[model samples]
Target: MFESIKYLQKGNQKRAYQAISELDIMKHLAAYNPILCGTLPIGIDIACSDLDIIMEVDEFERFEEQVRELYGNQQNFKVKKLHIRENPVIKANFWFSGFEFELFGQALPVKEQNAYLHMVIEDAVMKRHPSIKKEVIELKEKGWKTEPAFCKVLQLEEGDPYKELINYGKNTGFI
Candidate 1:
C-alpha cells in the first residue's frame, strides 16, 4: 500500500516497511501505535544515527517480554532505561535479519514529542541549504551532534539552535 509513497532515501522504503511491520505486530500484541521519526526520512542519516521512534504506549514491560520471546535473551538486544522530565522512557537497540532497530518508547502526549518537532525543523533547514546534508554527514562522522552540526552549517546562532530552527520552520511554513 505504501508503494505509491515515495521515500527520500534509497533504502528507506524497505526499512520503513520493516518498521511498520514491527509496529503492526506490536499493536496486535500490545495495542500501541508507534511512529517513526528521524533523519532517515529526509535522507541525511549518519552512521551513528538511530531510527528515532516515539510511542504513547505504557506497556513497555509487556513489549519487552514479547521482544525477548521473539528475539531471544537480553544479551542479543540491549535496553537502557532513562527518564525525561521525570517520565520514563525505554531505549532499545536490537538487530533482526541484519537490520538494526533503535526504538524509544514512552507514554507522552503527541504535542509534546520533541523528536518529531526537531525532525521537522531540521528538514526545513536542510531544504534551504541542500549542501547541509553532506556537511551533516561529515559532522556526524566526526562525532558531532546533528542539531549543532545543522546549526553550524546553517549559521543559526542567535541562541538555541533547536529553537531557532523551529522558528525558521514556522516562519517558512515548513512545519
Candidate 2:
C-alpha cells in the first residue's frame, strides 16, 4: 500500500512546507512510511489549515513512547488514543511555532489508514476533477464539517466519497 502511493507536495504553501518539515521529524519516529495527508497535501487548505500525518509503526508502544518523548512536553501539546469505527490509532495535536499539527500513528498491519488513504485518492480526484477543488475550497470556507459529506453535497462523486475513493485506489492499483 505504501509503495503504491507517493507523497504529495502541492498544497497551501506554508502548510506544505510545514508538512515537509514535520516529515523530517516524523522520519525518526517510524521505520515505515510517514505520510502527509488531508487538505494541505492537495492544495485546498486555507489559512486555518492543520497538518495531518500518518505513520506506520512496528511497535505501537515504543513508537508512542518516542512520540511522547519528542513532543509530549512541548507547550500546547495534547495526545489521545482514538478509535474511529473500530480502527485504533493514536493522535497528537498541538501548536508548534503557531502551526496546528496533528500526527496519527497506525500500528502494524496498518488496517486502513483512512485519513492517509483519503488524501491519496483525493489527490487523484483533484487531478481528474479540477473544478472539484474549487467546490471543496468553497465548502471548507462555508465550514462544511467533513470531506465525505462535502463531496456528497457538492456532487463531486457518486456514492460515498470515502468508499468510492478507496475503491478507486484499489481498482487503479494505487492502494
Candidate 3:
C-alpha cells in the first residue's frame, strides 16, 4: 500500500535518513501527492527533527486525508504544501507518525525506484552499517541533528536527486 512501510528500520541514522530521503524523493517523483511535508526552510530548524511530505491531489483534500489518517487513525505524520515549478510535482511540509512517515508528490513511475530503494534500504537496514538507524532513532528521541552516511558511502550529492534515485530504482528492479 504505502511504500514507506517497505522500509524496515534497523535503527540507524544514515539508514533512516537514507530511507527518509529515498522515500521522500520517491513520493515526489510519484507525484501521488505532489507536495512533500516537513521540508520548509522557514520553519523550525532541525535536520534531525523535521518531517517532510509529498502529496496526492489538491492541497486541501490532501490536508484532510492526512488529518483523518493522523487523528482518526492515530497516525504519526505531518503536512505542508509546496508548489514546485515542475509540473505535477509538489513538495510539502513533513512530520512523523511513529515510524511511519508520509511524503507525496507528482506521479513518478516507482516500479524502478522501489527496486533500487529497496536495495539501498535493504543494504542499510540489513547490512553495511546497521547502527546508523539506531543512532538516528536515539538522536531523534534526544532531538539532535543526524545525517545519513549511506548516501555518502554511495557518494550521492544532495543536488538534483532524481538521477540518483532512478539509478537506484533501475538497479534494484523496482521498475
Candidate 4:
C-alpha cells in the first residue's frame, strides 16, 4: 500500500509527489520495498523538512552501489554507512526537484524500520488528538526533531522517546 504516491498527490504533499514522480525514484528502487516516511507524510513538516524514503535492504554494499549509480551525480549527493540501534544502515542524501532527499536502508522490513514505525504512531497520535499537530509543527519550526517534539507535547517524560513512543502507541491502541 505504501508503494504508490497517489495519496501524496493531494494536500500539502502534492509537491513531494511531484518531486518523487519526476525523479522516478520508486521505479528505480523497486527491488527494495521503499516507503515514504517522516514529517511530510504525517503533516508536521516545517519549511526545511526533507523527503525520507525508507527501504528494506539485506545487503548494504549492493544498496549503496545501486543508490550511488542512481543518484550519486545529483547535487550535494553523498552516501555513508552507519549504525543505528546497533543495526547497520546505508543512507544517501541529495537535493532533487527542490527537495532534500534522504534514502535510508537497513536489513529490516520496511514496515519494521523505526522511521516507518514512528511515522505510523505519530500519524495515529495526531489523528486521535488533532491539536497535537499544531504543537508538533511549532516545535519542529523551533528546530526540534519530530520524536523529541512529540515527547514534549505528549508529556512522555521518561525513557527513550523513540522507543517509548512505540509503547505509548501500544498502550493507547494507536499503533
Candidate 5:
C-alpha cells in the first residue's frame, strides 16, 4: 500500500490501484465525517496512523461526540482527549490505528491572532468538500515556508497559521 501511494505521488497511474483502493476506504469513511472534503491531503508521506486532519471549531462541546462518531472506539480507531498548545484552548487528536492513519486536531484562541477558524470549519462541513487542497498546493508552490504558508494561501493578513491551514483544508473554497 505504501509503495502504491509513493507511485501515485510520482504521478504514476500503473500503481494507482493501491492509492485508489485506499481512497475507496477513505470514501467509505467519508460517510461518517460528513464534514471532511475530498480524499484527505495527498502528496505527503504518512503512516496510516499519521494525523490526517487537524481543524478548529467555534465550540468544543460536541467535538468528542463528533470524533467518536467519525472514528469509532475500536482498537483500530480511537480519538485522544483534547489538549492545548501555545494557548488557552483545546485541541484534539485521533488515531486511525488500523490503516496507520492518524489525523486529528483542534485549535482555540491565540495571542493577538484573530482568525475565523470556527467559521471556516462550519463552512467546510456545510459545503461537504475539501476546499483547501488547492490552496495548500498553491502555498507550497509560492515558496511559503513555515507560518507564512497560511497567510499566503488563505490571503489573510495575520492569524494562527496552524488553525488557518487546517481550516482552509476543511473548507469548500480557499478564500
Candidate 6:
C-alpha cells in the first residue's frame, strides 16, 4: 500500500507529492525499494516534518556512492553510516523542492524497518482513535518526535517508546 506516492497527491500531502516528483526520488532509488515513512504519511506532521524515505540496501558503499552522485550538489547534502538498534544503516539527507528529504537504507526489507513499522502502527492507531491525531500533532509541535508522541498519548510510559509502540502494535494486532 505504501509503494507509490499517489496517495500523497490528495489532501494536505500535495506539497510532498510535488516535492518527491520534482526530485524523482522513487525513480532514482528504485533499485533499493524505497518506501516513504514517518509522520507525514500518517498525517501527524508538523511544519518541520520531513520526507522520510526508507529502503532495502545490501551494499552500503554502492548506496552511499549513488546517493552522493545523485544528491551531492543539493543544498546541505550529507551522507553517513550509522547503527540503529545494532543494525548498520546508511543515511543521506538534503534539501530539495522546498522540503527536507531523509533517505535511509539498511539490509533489512523496507516493510520491516522501524520507521516503516512505526508509521504503520501509528496509522492504525490514528484510524482506530481518530481524535489522537490532533494530540499527536500537538506533541510533535511541542518538540516530541513521532514515536514518543504516540507513546505519551497512549500512556505507554514504560521502556523505550519505540519498542513499546511496536509491542503495542503487535498485541493489538496492528502490525
Best by TM-score: 6
Expressed as tens digits, the lDDT of each residue in 30-109 for candidate 1 is 34445567766667776545655565657778766755575444235887778975788876777654456666777775
Model 6: lDDT to the true structure:
0.92
lDDT of 6 at 48: 88
lDDT of each: 0.64, 0.65, 0.40, 0.89, 0.40, 0.92
Query: What is the per-residue lDDT of model 4 for residues 91-123, given as tens digits with 9 covering 90 to 100?
Result: 999999889999999989998888988888999
Give per-residue CA lDDT, model 6, range 88-154, as digits (tens).
Answer: 9989999997789999999999999889889999999999999999998888889998899899999
For model 3, what is the C-alpha lDDT against the true structure?
Answer: 0.40
Better of 4 and 5 by lDDT: 4
Q: Which candidate is the best by lDDT?
A: 6
Q: On residues 58-128, what C-alpha lDDT tens digit does candidate 5 reach at each position?
A: 45556656555655653455555554454444333433323344433344322122233432443443345
Q: Model 4 misses residue 164 by how many Å?
A: 1.3
Off by over 4 Å in 4: none
All candidates: CA RMSD in angstroms? 4.1, 4.0, 10.0, 1.1, 10.5, 0.8
Model 3, position 119: C-alpha lDDT score = 36
Q: Mind giving the per-residue lDDT tens digits that candidate 3 earns over 22-123?
A: 545444334443322221211222344444443344445564564555333334334445444345443333333323444444444442223224334434
TM-score, cand. 1: 0.70
Which consecutive 10 residues in model 6 have the weakest lDDT in total? Answer: 39-48
Local lDDT at 144 for model 3: 38
Q: Could you tell me the C-alpha RMSD of candidate 5 in Å?
A: 10.5
Candidate 3 local lDDT, residue 89:
42
State candidate 4's TM-score.
Answer: 0.96
